[model samples]
Target: MDLSYTDVANRYRRQTLSILADERPLSVSELASRIVAHPSNDATNESTETQVRKARLALYHVHLPKLDESGLVSYTHETGEVTVPEGVADDLAEIAETFRSQMDE
Candidate 1:
């Protein structure tokens, strides 16, 4: 929890660090697309919002759970919200850029 993304071993965590650079909570579906789409492409529409992927099961079943377990985010199945806890340092935004660049590659 204390280590930065460069020091952290899990790439998923690093990827998520970048995804959450916006420092706001997002619905599960939005999180999935943000994981794959370039930041410039992050647009939310009620019709297309749920269209991030088919059924969005992978995000529900896989990624969010992994993130939730680490205490990095708060996921509420009932509310469909994934929240980034406060108090994390702003240096993480750099990790987000790094992860974004890596995703571009």
Candidate 2:
């Protein structure tokens, strides 16, 4: 639930926030696909179905719940949907960009 920099600094969480920033109200599975497909995700091959499945599981059971707890995202368990709260997406994108730039350096 910590909304500290370290929380969003996590790769999966950061990616989730950034994706939600642009494409609000995505299902966790869809978010996982985007995360896996993201260019910065060097940890796995984006084209792999196994990788997507793994990412989806991690997002659903770990990242999304944590982000939801932190109030950065709204996650509906039954519907499997995730959304950033109103007016928060731009800020979330900025934070994610900051981290991305730092990591790039």
* Highest lDDT scorer: 2
Note the Cα lDDT for every prediction shown: 0.63, 0.80
| Model 1: per-residue Cα lDDT at residue 63 | 61
lDDT of 1 by residue, 1-105 (tens): 565333345544565567677756877777666655545343566544455573357668766676676566677899988777665536567656776776667
lDDT of 2 by residue, 1-97 (tens): 2368756757898888777767879998899888888877676434578888999999989888888888899999999999988757768878767
Candidate No. with top TM-score: 2
* lDDT for 88 (candidate 2): 73
Residue 30, model 1, lDDT: 71
TM-score of 1: 0.62
> What is the alpha-carbon lDDT for the whole of candidate 2?
0.80
TM-score list, all predictions: 0.62, 0.83
Error of 2 at 40 (Å): 1.2
Provide the clash count, candidate 1. 1
